[model samples]
Target: MVERKTIFSYLPHLILLIGIAVVAFPVYVAFVASTWDPATISNGQMPLRPGPHFLENYYQTIFVGTSRTTREPVGGMMFNSLVMALTIAIGKIAISIISAFAIVYFRFPFRMTAFWVIFVTLMLPVEVRIYPTYKIVSDLGLLDSYAGLTIPLIASATATLLFRQFFMTVPDELVEASKIDGAGPMQFFRDTLLPLSITSIAALFVIQFIYGWNQYLWPLLITTRDSMQTIVIGIKKMIVTQDALTEWQIAMATAVLAMLPPVLVVILMQRLFVKGLVETEK
Candidate 1:
Protein backbone atom coordinates (compact mmCIF):
# COMPACT_ATOMS: atom_id res chain seq x y z
CA MET A 1 0.00 0.00 0.00
CA VAL A 2 1.21 3.55 -0.72
CA GLU A 3 1.92 5.77 2.25
CA ARG A 4 -0.44 8.74 2.60
CA LYS A 5 0.87 12.29 3.00
CA THR A 6 -0.38 14.83 5.48
CA ILE A 7 -0.06 18.62 5.95
CA PHE A 8 2.67 18.01 8.57
CA SER A 9 4.63 15.86 6.12
CA TYR A 10 4.74 18.69 3.62
CA LEU A 11 5.85 21.30 6.18
CA PRO A 12 9.55 20.38 6.05
CA HIS A 13 9.64 20.55 2.25
CA LEU A 14 7.87 23.90 2.30
CA ILE A 15 10.31 25.24 4.89
CA LEU A 16 13.27 24.00 2.85
CA LEU A 17 11.95 25.67 -0.29
CA ILE A 18 11.52 28.93 1.55
CA GLY A 19 15.07 28.75 2.89
CA ILE A 20 16.37 28.07 -0.62
CA ALA A 21 14.52 31.07 -2.02
CA VAL A 22 15.82 33.34 0.73
CA VAL A 23 19.39 32.28 0.08
CA ALA A 24 19.18 32.18 -3.72
CA PHE A 25 17.38 35.49 -4.29
CA PRO A 26 20.43 37.61 -3.45
CA VAL A 27 22.67 35.53 -5.66
CA TYR A 28 20.14 35.83 -8.48
CA VAL A 29 20.07 39.62 -8.03
CA ALA A 30 23.86 39.72 -8.08
CA PHE A 31 23.93 37.76 -11.33
CA VAL A 32 21.40 40.15 -12.84
CA ALA A 33 23.40 43.15 -11.69
CA SER A 34 26.54 41.65 -13.17
CA THR A 35 24.88 41.52 -16.60
CA TRP A 36 23.96 45.19 -16.51
CA ASP A 37 26.05 48.30 -17.16
CA PRO A 38 27.54 50.30 -14.27
CA ALA A 39 25.17 53.23 -14.88
CA THR A 40 22.11 50.98 -14.69
CA ILE A 41 23.27 49.39 -11.46
CA SER A 42 24.40 52.71 -9.92
CA ASN A 43 21.24 54.58 -10.91
CA GLY A 44 19.10 51.73 -9.42
CA GLN A 45 17.56 51.17 -12.83
CA MET A 46 18.65 47.52 -13.02
CA PRO A 47 15.83 45.10 -13.85
CA LEU A 48 15.26 41.78 -12.13
CA ARG A 49 16.16 40.07 -15.39
CA PRO A 50 19.66 39.77 -16.84
CA GLY A 51 20.89 42.47 -19.23
CA PRO A 52 22.65 42.24 -22.60
CA HIS A 53 26.05 43.36 -21.27
CA PHE A 54 26.80 39.99 -19.62
CA LEU A 55 29.64 39.26 -22.02
CA GLU A 56 31.22 42.71 -21.72
CA ASN A 57 31.05 42.91 -17.91
CA TYR A 58 32.34 39.36 -17.38
CA TYR A 59 35.12 39.70 -19.96
CA GLN A 60 36.32 42.88 -18.27
CA THR A 61 36.03 41.35 -14.81
CA ILE A 62 37.86 38.14 -15.69
CA PHE A 63 40.56 39.16 -18.15
CA VAL A 64 40.80 42.92 -18.49
CA GLY A 65 41.53 44.17 -14.98
CA THR A 66 39.09 46.49 -13.22
CA SER A 67 39.66 50.23 -13.56
CA ARG A 68 39.58 51.84 -10.15
CA THR A 69 40.21 49.91 -6.94
CA THR A 70 42.09 46.83 -8.15
CA ARG A 71 44.14 46.81 -11.33
CA GLU A 72 44.64 43.00 -11.25
CA PRO A 73 42.23 40.84 -13.22
CA VAL A 74 39.84 38.46 -11.46
CA GLY A 75 41.49 35.57 -13.27
CA GLY A 76 44.78 36.02 -11.43
CA MET A 77 43.01 36.40 -8.13
CA MET A 78 41.06 33.19 -8.76
CA PHE A 79 44.30 31.34 -9.49
CA ASN A 80 45.80 32.55 -6.23
CA SER A 81 42.70 31.43 -4.37
CA LEU A 82 42.66 28.00 -6.05
CA VAL A 83 46.27 27.37 -5.12
CA MET A 84 45.80 28.45 -1.52
CA ALA A 85 42.61 26.39 -1.11
CA LEU A 86 43.99 23.16 -2.63
CA THR A 87 47.25 23.37 -0.69
CA ILE A 88 45.47 24.02 2.61
CA ALA A 89 42.91 21.23 2.06
CA ILE A 90 45.48 18.62 1.01
CA GLY A 91 48.03 19.66 3.61
CA LYS A 92 45.52 19.58 6.47
CA ILE A 93 44.28 16.12 5.46
CA ALA A 94 47.76 14.65 5.09
CA ILE A 95 49.06 16.05 8.35
CA SER A 96 45.92 15.34 10.37
CA ILE A 97 45.47 11.76 9.12
CA ILE A 98 49.07 10.86 9.80
CA SER A 99 48.98 12.46 13.22
CA ALA A 100 45.74 10.68 14.01
CA PHE A 101 47.11 7.32 12.83
CA ALA A 102 50.17 7.59 15.02
CA ILE A 103 48.16 8.64 18.06
CA VAL A 104 45.70 5.77 17.58
CA TYR A 105 47.88 2.89 16.38
CA PHE A 106 51.26 3.40 17.95
CA ARG A 107 51.75 3.01 21.68
CA PHE A 108 54.11 5.72 22.78
CA PRO A 109 54.68 7.73 25.90
CA PHE A 110 52.23 10.63 26.34
CA ARG A 111 50.05 9.33 23.50
CA MET A 112 46.87 10.59 25.08
CA THR A 113 48.71 13.72 26.17
CA ALA A 114 49.71 14.36 22.56
CA PHE A 115 46.15 13.82 21.37
CA TRP A 116 44.83 16.19 24.03
CA VAL A 117 47.39 18.79 23.01
CA ILE A 118 46.17 18.58 19.43
CA PHE A 119 42.57 18.77 20.59
CA VAL A 120 43.30 21.79 22.73
CA THR A 121 44.41 23.64 19.62
CA LEU A 122 40.82 23.68 18.51
CA MET A 123 40.27 26.37 21.13
CA LEU A 124 43.24 28.40 19.88
CA PRO A 125 42.21 29.21 16.33
CA VAL A 126 44.24 31.24 13.83
CA GLU A 127 42.75 34.52 14.96
CA VAL A 128 43.85 33.86 18.52
CA ARG A 129 47.42 33.10 17.45
CA ILE A 130 47.59 35.53 14.54
CA TYR A 131 50.25 37.79 15.98
CA PRO A 132 53.01 35.27 16.62
CA THR A 133 52.02 33.28 13.57
CA TYR A 134 52.27 36.37 11.39
CA LYS A 135 55.61 37.28 12.92
CA ILE A 136 57.01 33.85 12.17
CA VAL A 137 55.66 33.84 8.63
CA SER A 138 56.96 37.33 8.02
CA ASP A 139 60.38 36.48 9.41
CA LEU A 140 60.51 33.37 7.25
CA GLY A 141 59.96 35.51 4.13
CA LEU A 142 56.65 33.82 3.29
CA LEU A 143 54.67 37.06 3.05
CA ASP A 144 52.98 37.63 -0.32
CA SER A 145 53.52 33.94 -1.15
CA TYR A 146 51.17 30.92 -1.31
CA ALA A 147 52.97 29.44 1.69
CA GLY A 148 52.14 32.55 3.67
CA LEU A 149 48.49 32.23 2.67
CA THR A 150 48.17 28.52 3.60
CA ILE A 151 50.87 27.12 5.92
CA PRO A 152 49.89 28.91 9.09
CA LEU A 153 46.27 27.88 8.58
CA ILE A 154 46.78 24.23 7.58
CA ALA A 155 47.36 22.35 10.87
CA SER A 156 43.63 21.79 11.43
CA ALA A 157 43.37 20.33 14.91
CA THR A 158 39.68 19.67 14.32
CA ALA A 159 40.47 17.39 11.41
CA THR A 160 43.08 15.55 13.47
CA LEU A 161 40.52 14.93 16.22
CA LEU A 162 37.97 13.76 13.67
CA PHE A 163 40.41 11.30 12.12
CA ARG A 164 41.41 10.09 15.56
CA GLN A 165 37.78 9.42 16.39
CA PHE A 166 37.22 7.54 13.14
CA PHE A 167 40.41 5.53 13.60
CA MET A 168 39.30 4.46 17.08
CA THR A 169 36.06 3.06 15.68
CA VAL A 170 38.03 0.72 13.36
CA PRO A 171 38.00 -2.88 14.59
CA ASP A 172 41.18 -4.42 15.93
CA GLU A 173 40.42 -7.60 13.96
CA LEU A 174 41.18 -5.73 10.76
CA VAL A 175 44.60 -4.75 12.09
CA GLU A 176 45.35 -8.36 13.02
CA ALA A 177 44.18 -9.60 9.63
CA SER A 178 46.38 -7.07 7.89
CA LYS A 179 49.38 -8.21 9.90
CA ILE A 180 48.63 -11.84 9.14
CA ASP A 181 48.54 -10.93 5.46
CA GLY A 182 52.11 -9.61 5.77
CA ALA A 183 51.13 -5.95 5.78
CA GLY A 184 53.27 -3.54 7.75
CA PRO A 185 52.03 -0.35 9.35
CA MET A 186 52.58 1.72 6.22
CA GLN A 187 51.15 -1.01 3.99
CA PHE A 188 48.01 -1.35 6.09
CA PHE A 189 47.57 2.40 6.17
CA ARG A 190 48.14 2.75 2.47
CA ASP A 191 45.93 -0.14 1.38
CA THR A 192 43.25 -0.17 4.04
CA LEU A 193 42.93 3.05 6.03
CA LEU A 194 43.30 5.37 3.07
CA PRO A 195 40.51 3.67 1.15
CA LEU A 196 38.27 3.72 4.21
CA SER A 197 38.98 7.39 4.83
CA ILE A 198 38.06 8.59 1.34
CA THR A 199 34.68 9.98 2.35
CA SER A 200 36.07 11.67 5.43
CA ILE A 201 38.85 13.16 3.34
CA ALA A 202 36.37 14.48 0.79
CA ALA A 203 34.29 16.02 3.56
CA LEU A 204 37.25 17.74 5.14
CA PHE A 205 38.58 18.83 1.77
CA VAL A 206 35.33 20.63 1.01
CA ILE A 207 35.34 22.37 4.40
CA GLN A 208 38.97 23.36 4.25
CA PHE A 209 38.76 24.43 0.61
CA ILE A 210 35.94 26.85 1.38
CA TYR A 211 37.77 28.02 4.49
CA GLY A 212 40.84 28.82 2.41
CA TRP A 213 38.90 30.35 -0.46
CA ASN A 214 37.00 32.72 1.83
CA GLN A 215 40.04 33.77 3.80
CA TYR A 216 40.26 37.57 3.96
CA LEU A 217 41.90 38.82 7.15
CA TRP A 218 44.99 36.58 7.04
CA PRO A 219 45.54 37.07 3.32
CA LEU A 220 44.98 40.80 3.67
CA LEU A 221 47.64 41.04 6.37
CA ILE A 222 50.17 38.96 4.47
CA THR A 223 49.81 39.95 0.86
CA THR A 224 51.03 43.38 -0.21
CA ARG A 225 50.95 42.84 -3.96
CA ASP A 226 47.77 43.05 -6.03
CA SER A 227 48.86 39.98 -8.00
CA MET A 228 48.82 37.86 -4.83
CA GLN A 229 45.22 38.66 -3.87
CA THR A 230 42.56 35.94 -3.68
CA ILE A 231 39.08 36.18 -5.19
CA VAL A 232 37.52 37.16 -1.86
CA ILE A 233 40.02 39.96 -1.49
CA GLY A 234 39.49 40.94 -5.08
CA ILE A 235 35.79 41.39 -4.47
CA LYS A 236 36.48 43.62 -1.50
CA LYS A 237 38.90 45.74 -3.47
CA MET A 238 36.64 46.05 -6.50
CA ILE A 239 33.97 47.94 -4.53
CA VAL A 240 35.74 51.19 -3.71
CA THR A 241 34.62 53.46 -0.88
CA GLN A 242 33.78 56.07 -3.50
CA ASP A 243 30.54 54.88 -5.05
CA ALA A 244 30.90 56.65 -8.38
CA LEU A 245 34.47 55.41 -8.95
CA THR A 246 33.55 51.81 -8.05
CA GLU A 247 32.58 49.62 -11.01
CA TRP A 248 29.33 48.09 -9.74
CA GLN A 249 28.77 45.74 -12.63
CA ILE A 250 32.36 44.47 -12.56
CA ALA A 251 32.25 44.01 -8.79
CA MET A 252 28.99 42.07 -9.04
CA ALA A 253 30.45 39.93 -11.79
CA THR A 254 33.52 39.26 -9.66
CA ALA A 255 31.27 38.36 -6.75
CA VAL A 256 29.38 35.86 -8.88
CA LEU A 257 32.60 34.35 -10.18
CA ALA A 258 34.03 34.13 -6.66
CA MET A 259 31.13 31.87 -5.64
CA LEU A 260 31.47 29.41 -8.55
CA PRO A 261 34.49 27.35 -7.45
CA PRO A 262 33.32 26.54 -3.93
CA VAL A 263 29.80 25.84 -5.18
CA LEU A 264 31.18 23.48 -7.81
CA VAL A 265 33.34 21.73 -5.21
CA VAL A 266 30.37 21.13 -2.90
CA ILE A 267 28.23 19.93 -5.80
CA LEU A 268 30.88 17.51 -7.02
CA MET A 269 31.62 16.06 -3.58
CA GLN A 270 28.05 16.17 -2.21
CA ARG A 271 27.82 12.37 -2.05
CA LEU A 272 31.09 11.68 -0.22
CA PHE A 273 30.68 14.74 1.96
CA VAL A 274 27.24 13.68 3.17
CA LYS A 275 28.37 10.08 3.66
CA GLY A 276 31.36 11.14 5.73
CA LEU A 277 29.19 13.27 8.00
CA VAL A 278 26.33 10.77 8.55
CA GLU A 279 28.04 7.38 8.35
CA THR A 280 28.62 5.84 11.75
CA GLU A 281 29.59 2.19 11.34
CA LYS A 282 32.58 1.09 9.24
Candidate 2:
Protein backbone atom coordinates (compact mmCIF):
# COMPACT_ATOMS: atom_id res chain seq x y z
CA MET A 1 0.00 0.00 0.00
CA VAL A 2 1.17 3.53 -0.82
CA GLU A 3 1.70 5.90 2.10
CA ARG A 4 -0.57 8.98 2.23
CA LYS A 5 1.06 12.42 1.98
CA THR A 6 0.42 14.92 4.78
CA ILE A 7 1.26 18.58 5.50
CA PHE A 8 3.53 17.56 8.41
CA SER A 9 5.50 15.30 6.08
CA TYR A 10 6.38 18.32 3.93
CA LEU A 11 7.63 20.37 6.89
CA PRO A 12 11.21 19.09 6.86
CA HIS A 13 11.55 19.72 3.13
CA LEU A 14 10.19 23.26 3.53
CA ILE A 15 12.58 23.96 6.41
CA LEU A 16 15.52 22.64 4.36
CA LEU A 17 14.55 24.82 1.42
CA ILE A 18 14.36 27.86 3.73
CA GLY A 19 17.82 27.05 5.12
CA ILE A 20 19.22 26.71 1.59
CA ALA A 21 17.76 30.08 0.60
CA VAL A 22 19.20 31.75 3.68
CA VAL A 23 22.66 30.38 2.94
CA ALA A 24 22.57 30.86 -0.82
CA PHE A 25 21.22 34.45 -0.96
CA PRO A 26 24.48 36.06 0.19
CA VAL A 27 26.50 33.94 -2.23
CA TYR A 28 24.15 34.97 -5.03
CA VAL A 29 24.61 38.63 -4.05
CA ALA A 30 28.36 38.17 -4.08
CA PHE A 31 28.22 36.65 -7.57
CA VAL A 32 26.00 39.49 -8.74
CA ALA A 33 28.34 42.07 -7.20
CA SER A 34 31.33 40.45 -8.88
CA THR A 35 29.75 41.09 -12.29
CA TRP A 36 29.32 44.81 -11.54
CA ASP A 37 31.70 47.74 -11.77
CA PRO A 38 33.57 49.09 -8.75
CA ALA A 39 31.72 52.41 -8.88
CA THR A 40 28.32 50.70 -8.96
CA ILE A 41 29.26 48.54 -5.94
CA SER A 42 30.95 51.36 -3.94
CA ASN A 43 28.11 53.82 -4.62
CA GLY A 44 25.54 51.26 -3.37
CA GLN A 45 23.89 51.20 -6.80
CA MET A 46 24.60 47.55 -7.56
CA PRO A 47 21.49 45.77 -8.82
CA LEU A 48 20.37 42.40 -7.52
CA ARG A 49 20.64 41.08 -11.07
CA PRO A 50 23.96 40.18 -12.72
CA GLY A 51 25.94 43.10 -14.15
CA PRO A 52 27.68 43.55 -17.52
CA HIS A 53 31.30 43.66 -16.29
CA PHE A 54 31.52 39.95 -15.44
CA LEU A 55 34.31 39.06 -17.85
CA GLU A 56 36.29 42.28 -17.24
CA ASN A 57 36.10 41.97 -13.46
CA TYR A 58 37.13 38.29 -13.47
CA TYR A 59 39.94 38.85 -15.99
CA GLN A 60 41.32 41.68 -13.88
CA THR A 61 40.94 39.70 -10.69
CA ILE A 62 42.69 36.59 -12.09
CA PHE A 63 45.36 38.15 -14.31
CA VAL A 64 45.84 41.88 -13.64
CA GLY A 65 46.63 42.37 -9.97
CA THR A 66 44.37 44.47 -7.74
CA SER A 67 45.63 48.02 -7.05
CA ARG A 68 45.29 48.86 -3.39
CA THR A 69 46.39 46.24 -0.87
CA THR A 70 47.49 43.12 -2.77
CA ARG A 71 49.37 43.68 -5.98
CA GLU A 72 49.67 39.95 -6.67
CA PRO A 73 47.09 38.54 -9.05
CA VAL A 74 44.40 36.25 -7.67
CA GLY A 75 45.77 33.41 -9.80
CA GLY A 76 49.10 33.30 -7.97
CA MET A 77 47.39 33.24 -4.59
CA MET A 78 45.09 30.45 -5.82
CA PHE A 79 48.16 28.45 -6.91
CA ASN A 80 49.73 28.85 -3.50
CA SER A 81 46.49 27.76 -1.86
CA LEU A 82 46.25 24.75 -4.19
CA VAL A 83 49.76 23.59 -3.37
CA MET A 84 49.23 23.99 0.35
CA ALA A 85 45.89 22.23 0.26
CA LEU A 86 47.09 19.26 -1.80
CA THR A 87 50.20 18.83 0.32
CA ILE A 88 48.25 19.00 3.58
CA ALA A 89 45.55 16.59 2.36
CA ILE A 90 48.00 14.02 1.00
CA GLY A 91 50.46 14.32 3.85
CA LYS A 92 47.74 14.00 6.49
CA ILE A 93 46.32 10.90 4.81
CA ALA A 94 49.66 9.17 4.33
CA ILE A 95 50.92 9.88 7.83
CA SER A 96 47.60 9.24 9.57
CA ILE A 97 46.93 5.99 7.70
CA ILE A 98 50.42 4.67 8.44
CA SER A 99 50.16 5.64 12.08
CA ALA A 100 46.74 4.06 12.39
CA PHE A 101 47.93 0.88 10.70
CA ALA A 102 50.85 0.60 13.06
CA ILE A 103 48.73 1.31 16.08
CA VAL A 104 46.16 -1.29 15.13
CA TYR A 105 48.47 -4.08 13.93
CA PHE A 106 51.93 -3.74 15.40
CA ARG A 107 53.01 -4.53 18.93
CA PHE A 108 55.46 -1.95 20.12
CA PRO A 109 56.56 -0.46 23.39
CA PHE A 110 54.27 2.34 24.63
CA ARG A 111 51.88 1.90 21.67
CA MET A 112 48.82 3.01 23.58
CA THR A 113 50.86 5.82 25.10
CA ALA A 114 51.81 7.04 21.64
CA PHE A 115 48.21 6.89 20.48
CA TRP A 116 47.11 8.82 23.58
CA VAL A 117 49.79 11.43 22.97
CA ILE A 118 48.58 11.94 19.43
CA PHE A 119 44.99 12.12 20.66
CA VAL A 120 45.94 14.69 23.30
CA THR A 121 47.24 17.03 20.60
CA LEU A 122 43.66 17.47 19.36
CA MET A 123 43.24 19.89 22.26
CA LEU A 124 46.38 21.87 21.29
CA PRO A 125 45.41 23.27 17.92
CA VAL A 126 47.62 25.48 15.76
CA GLU A 127 46.27 28.66 17.35
CA VAL A 128 47.35 27.53 20.77
CA ARG A 129 50.86 26.63 19.62
CA ILE A 130 51.27 29.41 17.09
CA TYR A 131 54.01 31.39 18.80
CA PRO A 132 56.56 28.63 19.20
CA THR A 133 55.69 27.09 15.87
CA TYR A 134 56.23 30.46 14.22
CA LYS A 135 59.51 30.99 15.99
CA ILE A 136 60.79 27.60 14.86
CA VAL A 137 59.74 28.13 11.25
CA SER A 138 61.30 31.59 11.29
CA ASP A 139 64.55 30.30 12.74
CA LEU A 140 64.69 27.59 10.09
CA GLY A 141 64.26 30.22 7.36
CA LEU A 142 61.12 28.49 6.09
CA LEU A 143 59.08 31.70 6.15
CA ASP A 144 57.22 32.48 2.90
CA SER A 145 57.91 28.93 1.68
CA TYR A 146 55.51 26.09 0.76
CA ALA A 147 57.19 23.90 3.36
CA GLY A 148 56.43 26.49 5.99
CA LEU A 149 52.82 26.74 4.86
CA THR A 150 52.14 22.97 4.92
CA ILE A 151 54.62 21.09 7.13
CA PRO A 152 53.51 22.49 10.47
CA LEU A 153 49.83 21.87 9.83
CA ILE A 154 50.09 18.42 8.26
CA ALA A 155 50.17 16.26 11.40
CA SER A 156 46.46 15.75 11.93
CA ALA A 157 45.22 14.13 15.13
CA THR A 158 41.65 14.05 13.89
CA ALA A 159 42.54 12.13 10.76
CA THR A 160 44.68 9.75 12.75
CA LEU A 161 41.79 9.10 15.14
CA LEU A 162 39.40 8.51 12.27
CA PHE A 163 41.72 6.06 10.54
CA ARG A 164 42.45 4.34 13.81
CA GLN A 165 38.78 3.84 14.58
CA PHE A 166 38.17 2.45 11.09
CA PHE A 167 41.14 0.12 11.33
CA MET A 168 39.95 -1.25 14.68
CA THR A 169 36.78 -2.51 13.03
CA VAL A 170 38.68 -4.68 10.50
CA PRO A 171 38.09 -8.40 11.08
CA ASP A 172 40.79 -10.68 12.50
CA GLU A 173 40.08 -13.15 9.70
CA LEU A 174 41.49 -10.73 7.15
CA VAL A 175 44.77 -10.48 9.06
CA GLU A 176 45.01 -14.27 9.25
CA ALA A 177 44.21 -14.59 5.57
CA SER A 178 46.95 -12.11 4.72
CA LYS A 179 49.43 -14.07 6.84
CA ILE A 180 48.46 -17.36 5.20
CA ASP A 181 48.96 -15.76 1.79
CA GLY A 182 52.53 -14.84 2.76
CA ALA A 183 51.72 -11.13 2.98
CA GLY A 184 54.13 -9.08 5.03
CA PRO A 185 52.98 -6.00 6.95
CA MET A 186 53.83 -3.67 4.08
CA GLN A 187 52.26 -6.03 1.55
CA PHE A 188 49.10 -6.29 3.57
CA PHE A 189 48.88 -2.54 4.01
CA ARG A 190 49.61 -1.86 0.38
CA ASP A 191 47.43 -4.54 -1.21
CA THR A 192 44.62 -5.09 1.27
CA LEU A 193 44.16 -2.11 3.59
CA LEU A 194 44.74 0.58 0.99
CA PRO A 195 42.00 -0.73 -1.26
CA LEU A 196 39.62 -1.08 1.66
CA SER A 197 40.25 2.45 2.96
CA ILE A 198 39.67 4.33 -0.30
CA THR A 199 36.34 5.87 0.65
CA SER A 200 37.63 7.05 4.03
CA ILE A 201 40.71 8.49 2.38
CA ALA A 202 38.56 10.38 -0.11
CA ALA A 203 36.45 11.83 2.67
CA LEU A 204 39.48 12.90 4.68
CA PHE A 205 41.19 14.40 1.65
CA VAL A 206 38.17 16.61 0.94
CA ILE A 207 38.15 17.82 4.53
CA GLN A 208 41.92 18.45 4.79
CA PHE A 209 41.98 20.14 1.41
CA ILE A 210 39.31 22.65 2.47
CA TYR A 211 41.08 23.09 5.79
CA GLY A 212 44.34 23.98 4.04
CA TRP A 213 42.71 26.15 1.37
CA ASN A 214 40.85 28.34 3.87
CA GLN A 215 43.83 28.83 6.17
CA TYR A 216 44.18 32.53 7.02
CA LEU A 217 45.80 33.27 10.38
CA TRP A 218 48.71 30.85 10.05
CA PRO A 219 49.47 31.98 6.52
CA LEU A 220 49.12 35.60 7.59
CA LEU A 221 51.66 35.08 10.36
CA ILE A 222 54.17 33.12 8.28
CA THR A 223 54.03 34.75 4.87
CA THR A 224 55.05 38.35 4.18
CA ARG A 225 55.50 38.11 0.43
CA ASP A 226 52.45 38.58 -1.83
CA SER A 227 53.48 35.56 -3.93
CA MET A 228 53.17 33.25 -0.91
CA GLN A 229 49.62 34.25 0.02
CA THR A 230 46.60 31.91 -0.18
CA ILE A 231 43.25 32.72 -1.82
CA VAL A 232 41.66 33.41 1.56
CA ILE A 233 44.36 35.94 2.46
CA GLY A 234 44.19 37.44 -1.01
CA ILE A 235 40.45 38.01 -0.60
CA LYS A 236 41.04 39.70 2.76
CA LYS A 237 43.72 41.94 1.24
CA MET A 238 41.50 43.00 -1.66
CA ILE A 239 38.88 44.52 0.64
CA VAL A 240 40.67 47.53 2.03
CA THR A 241 39.44 49.39 5.11
CA GLN A 242 38.87 52.41 2.84
CA ASP A 243 35.66 51.50 1.01
CA ALA A 244 36.14 53.88 -1.92
CA LEU A 245 39.61 52.59 -2.85
CA THR A 246 38.78 48.91 -2.37
CA GLU A 247 38.10 46.96 -5.55
CA TRP A 248 34.78 45.51 -4.51
CA GLN A 249 34.15 43.83 -7.83
CA ILE A 250 37.55 42.17 -7.93
CA ALA A 251 37.25 41.11 -4.30
CA MET A 252 33.86 39.60 -4.94
CA ALA A 253 35.21 37.82 -7.96
CA THR A 254 38.10 36.43 -5.94
CA ALA A 255 35.67 35.23 -3.26
CA VAL A 256 33.61 33.45 -5.88
CA LEU A 257 36.70 31.87 -7.45
CA ALA A 258 37.99 30.79 -4.04
CA MET A 259 34.80 28.77 -3.45
CA LEU A 260 35.06 26.75 -6.69
CA PRO A 261 37.76 24.16 -5.87
CA PRO A 262 36.24 23.03 -2.56
CA VAL A 263 32.80 22.86 -4.11
CA LEU A 264 34.10 20.74 -6.98
CA VAL A 265 35.93 18.39 -4.61
CA VAL A 266 32.76 17.87 -2.57
CA ILE A 267 30.67 17.28 -5.69
CA LEU A 268 33.11 14.80 -7.16
CA MET A 269 33.58 12.89 -3.91
CA GLN A 270 30.00 13.10 -2.61
CA ARG A 271 29.28 9.36 -2.93
CA LEU A 272 32.55 8.12 -1.36
CA PHE A 273 32.38 10.78 1.35
CA VAL A 274 28.91 9.75 2.44
CA LYS A 275 29.90 6.08 2.35
CA GLY A 276 33.09 6.67 4.30
CA LEU A 277 31.17 8.30 7.10
CA VAL A 278 28.29 5.82 7.27
CA GLU A 279 29.53 2.47 5.96
CA THR A 280 30.74 -0.22 8.38
CA GLU A 281 31.36 -3.60 6.70
CA LYS A 282 34.11 -4.20 4.21
Clashes per candidate, residues 3 or more apart or on different chains: 0, 0
For model 2, the run of ten residues with the poorest summed lDDT: 273-282
The parts of candidate 1 lying over 4 Å away from their true place are: 1-16, 275-282
Clashes of 2: 0
TM-score for every candidate vs. truth?
0.91, 0.92
Q: Please report the candidate that would top TM-score against the real structure.
A: 2
Model 2: per-residue lDDT, tens digit, 102-169? 99999999999999988898889888888999999999999999999999998878888888888888
Q: What residue pairs clash in candidate 2, if any at all?
A: none
